[model samples]
Target: MDTQYTALARRFRPQTFSEVVGQERIAQTLRNAILENRVAHAYLFTGARGVGKTSMARIFAKALNCPNTKDGVPCNECEICRGISAGNDVDVSEIDGASNRGIDDIRSLRANVNVRSMRSKYKVYIIDEVHMLTKEAFNALLKTLEEPPPLVKFVFCTTEPNKVPDTILSRCQRFDFGTISTDNIEIRLSQLAEAEGFTVDQEALELVARRAAGSMRDSQSLFDQLLAFGAQHITAADVHRLLGTAPDQRLIDLIEAMIDRRRDAALSQFQVALNDGVQLEAFTDQLLNYFRDLMVAACGAEGVQLLSVGRDCLPKLQEQSRRWGLENVVAALQIFADTKGRMQRVTYGRALAELALVRLSLLADMERLDDLLSQLKAGNAVVASGTARPTSAPPPRLAASTSPVPAPSLPAQKKNERLTPPPAEVASGADSPVTGSRDPAPIEAAAPPPVIAFQPGLEAELHRLMLSRLTDMTGTHLAKVVSTAISGPNRLDFSFSASYDIGRKACERPEVQARLESLVKELTGQDVRIQFRTVVTEAPEAKPQPAQPTNSRRKVVESPEDPLVQEVAKTFGIERWLRQEVLAEVVEAPAGGDLPEE
Candidate 1:
């Protein structure tokens, strides 16, 4: 006959209270309670699956009925201990609550509780998945729970405590078991590997531990799978292959490429991973975890440990930390966190993951404090040097050409200068016009033609002037609401869009209406009607044509001043205003104004 190799989890199942890992506090508390004879009639243990809830329950039962007990621990050699361990104890019963959760089961349990123990001082009943019990069953069992026989002890275990009724929870002493830590799981796995004569790397064990996600049963199951995959020795590469996980080296390479600003290399690495059939979401999750580790290491906390990778990777993490500032690391983490949620709804998960990676790489290019300061210093130097030098002086003015005709000095002077009579003579005698008169009609001197000021495009000019004056008076609140349009010759309409209640209110007020009317009359020298109406007039659209070249024969048009342009010029300074002035001068100046001086 050949002997078989029992799994490490079963081989090392905690037979005594002290053998349990990471649960010493729970064991000690239970032992103290038992010693003091303060044991509750019913006990409920709740936790994630497989953190030794069931095992602890069995240990407690053996401690209670051990034939020869020492310090609240069972003597495994005793017949009662052997019977309980073998699941054959006459007075101890293990019930699967999931299978027996009806009223009939409760009735059977009620009938059994009345009977005395066959071989032990107490009759112990253990029910797993107690949350699965039906409402009727719970109601039926409530009486038994409130007053069970002194010889009966009930133990209930459940993964989901919320499903259990409040009455049942209140009746039992609940013990909440926490998920095992990765360190504890790693230690356990390492010990098991050592005892089984199999070599395992630290990274491999850590991989197993993390894959377990803090569940001892899961870790043990994974350990068994890994052992089977790698017959005698387990390495990180083997673990990666078995778990379908990308290697840490590959991840480090990708991160290094991003940190180094090697966009092509990073993209190539991503393509390779995709070609290998590695899950995009999984790869992203791993990279995100790596960055998280880097952030932790950057924080300089001793407790920040990577449970999935080797300690050797810490150097790489530190090196990568130099490339990212605190803010960028935080922003990258946020992007990855958001990407994780988005990946679920997206049909093309690979593209989204790749996009996230590319975004992160670009974020890595963000300037650090020192780099930004250096750039600022360089810019300031250029500005200072360039501004210190004056622009080239306007080309030297050409000396007036010497006139060839030489006449009397006074006559030459008279020819160069215009001669005009005194103001009294000119005012009294209008017939004698001034010399060098380009316009002969000016001889009339009729009140100086009322100082005629030519305003090009009077309609547009009036509309702009009115908008500015109205905006200044009302501020932005009313300015945005009121719209002005040229209705007819020298006539402008004041209308309100649906957005402006204030505009309507102001228009209704006689004072505001009167003030606007007077201002228009003063500015345009035209009688204007300040009529208020709800109807909104459509703005006239200019016909579209091919864009005119700089020297094309198309007429140049000036745009009305908008609030945004005025506000920006006011806030930023006169530089923007000066630039606008220069543009206007360039556009309106005669064609020869910009010609090089000869």
Candidate 2:
């Protein structure tokens, strides 16, 4: 092609290392090697596309063969330079590795590698997309790659360095190129626009730069297209119009509305953009980029490089980042991404996108389960029943009330009754004024009754805790038998059966005591000492007394569910257990007395 009609990427191809853009480090390293007379046998160039990989390879080949060189730069005026620039030279071969990937091609190259250079001091082989070579081809080229003739040099350029085997990687001197910054690409585009006699908004150039995504050739190609479309001058609006997408301002407005939870405003903005023919998926993509900018802004100044937004966008993004935490920003991004994915399959893409918009707006109201349960007592074990696991909804609340235990020596019933509070209505009824004299009794002022410090409920607590948890502990006798507890000022004592000597000893361990004490403090907010003692059982002597009927049996009577039992039944929801009763069946009773129900 004529120079005047050639594409920008080919027209501006770098003829030397210095002419290549955004790869100063790699270029400088190769230049230094040449200046030091220390060139490697094989060179591997790896990086993203349009980031100067193949271009750098060509420059290296030119610098190696250029007769008139200064500071490792090739004189483009030389016949060797012109020949390499046009990709036609006797001593230099630029092979496309994608097409010539077979073992036969490699064998043919290997055969040609031994031949002397036709003209230049060295034969340079530039293999582009070298990773596309077949496994057999790679294996066939390995020996030649490892020990090529001193008259020959190899340059391998590939975007995917990882696809190349480590065996091959170890044989070459590798240099990785990075994506060109948007600022760098913008600068280059502006320079190109000036060279091509056109004018464009700085923002317009930035759009093209971002579209390029750090590939110089790609940026140049896009700029060439935009220039042809806009002729002499293009503004940022012109770029957005040509791209057939909503303007950046529209996206920014929609997100700001969502962040502030102005649902109506956001909806109107979205509808307007849709009516204006903006693509839903493309709008979602823009929203993703917008949220990404916000997330990076939330990360503070250190993460600024992660954003692709420009100068005018930074302040607004920073302001919006303060409206929501980084977590909310991340959640919004995820919702938008899901909406975009669902848009591909669903007919009602608009409704799905709107749902995502509403979800993002309501992210502040969302609560995690841990936060929801933070107010409840942690000691209350809410275990999931294996047979009753819920498929969708949350698991049911299963709470087992602490069962009362009988102390061997202590009046366990009355003592435990003192620990519990009485029924609200009954106590209030008892406090009601009686139908006696209205005059108050005259007496000296007296101190109030002392407050019980330790939790007597702690005993039932210890009992239920032991049954549910310690029954599985090996060598623990505390779980083998029923136990009881009593509160004495600041002390809580646990009395167990004498048969559980082993379990009692296990409870006596210091670590076990400390652990239980911590658990007690958590349960009752008390730090009282815990005493584990065995209740002794004495053998009773047989004494003669009045004889009773051998066949007569009586039904033992238990009181109705008291207010505390009712309260417990309502609170922990163990009503069925509280309602159960064990009865001694009555035989046929003598006449006159009402017979117990069968």
Candidate 3:
């Protein structure tokens, strides 16, 4: 009985507007309006729980009714101020919308609203959880809210503003409160600890603040619990014990395992946590928060500030974040997030937790198909995910091979030697692979045709085919409408311009695309799938031609001023007159100078 005590949240609640945290802008505006006597008849206060919605309402009422009000602040010593603060004033009524949320309750409120105030100038009606009112109740209250008496001021507070009818909301001046920051919460806790002579560590204070999630009331309530439990001192270890989270070290180790693709290690750690009496749901929630921090850390310095975790936790997080690509981080989050729902459906949450962790540990295996294909093309040793490196390396290929011998690569075995270039000795007929051979085989002339991989580059080859084959078979119009064709495995896709709708429709007919595919198959000797569609895009802007690339193999382009060049450029709609004038200026200049300034 002697241990009973009032909660710290209620014991040190803010009595003045200035003491409000994390919502200074709203507080200052309200105080200015009250001083100017511009207070609205009905004010709606909205925000999350414990963010000071109800407290601000009380402060405003006290400011208006306190006998010794100064600078729009309540004088706590006054009779009216004390009564309003305690919710015992004759003039002030504090209603719980949850308990009396019917039309009859609203009618009763309307009847009393017009009655004169006995003790104060303004009769303030403060309703908490105002959104609990029924549809009819809200409709009944709307008229009063729209035009309440001059002496009656209504204040409705709710955690959800969206649920409140828009008609009712439009008539009231609404103020939204923001969640308190960890720094602000920590500072307040520090002040409370010093005044109360509690020996709480800064790390413990930080944990409490973060756990509060931007609610001052929630943080203060937690501080009260710690005081009751610890009596004299609170440490970081005490915070962890109270919170029931996996130890900080264990969380770090598990995440590192996931990053390194150590599936067994991560699963082992998860089993240890489960055996240690940790709740699967709580453990997963904490882990989700940990990764949430990792996500912010992944954004670099700009994101680090958002974590608000202890100093000891940030450096390692930043270092680890650099190794996790954004895709991997997002995928890991999704897997664990999805597990939360499945856990609720099953009695054994532990199994679900293990499955999710195992999935995370093997996340690296989920590479895009395009990346795997590129690796196949590069001849690199593509290590399978979640496995240790093999003592013997993959079959030798150009990207991974040290010796000059051709690689036994990923593509069809028949083309292995054909794709690889001949060794220098074999190519020059110096110590040729063939015995008793004086002259080498004609390599380039006899080399098999280059294999077609059905990549976009095949578009150029398709254009050449259409220009030659289709022009002969179907004529110029058909070939010209085709534009170009891009290829994929057994597939070719082409689109026609918006202006060429007739051609687009004609090519899209099953007969046309099939015929085109057959023509490609005849040339490449591989069956191809053909796709055609209509597309519209902005016309390309004219660009100045770039100077041609230089090498010894090709001759220089003709000078722009050449008579033949001028004629040729004119034929192509190029401005040869500009080039002629530039050439003429150079030709007319006197050689060796202008008579030396003398």
Lowest summed lDDT across 10 adjacent residues in model 3 is found at 423-432
lDDT by residue (tens digit), candidate 3, 445-550: 2322223334554465445545455533343445545455554567776666688777767766787767877666655656878776777878899899999875
Ranking by lDDT: 3, 2, 1
- Model 1 residue runs over 4 Å out of place are 1-6, 273-282, 342-347, 364-598
Which pairs of residues have clashing backbones in candidate 2?
A: 477-503, 478-503
Residue 309, model 3: lDDT of: 51
Best by TM-score: 3
Question: Deviation in angstroms for 394 in model 1?
Answer: 24
Off by over 4 Å in 2: 1-5, 302-308, 330-352, 366-598
Q: How does candidate 3 fare on TM-score? A: 0.66
**Residue 28 in candidate 1 has what lDDT?**
91
TM-score for candidate 1, please give it: 0.61
The candidate with the higher lDDT, 1 or 2, is 2
Candidate 1 global CA lDDT score: 0.71
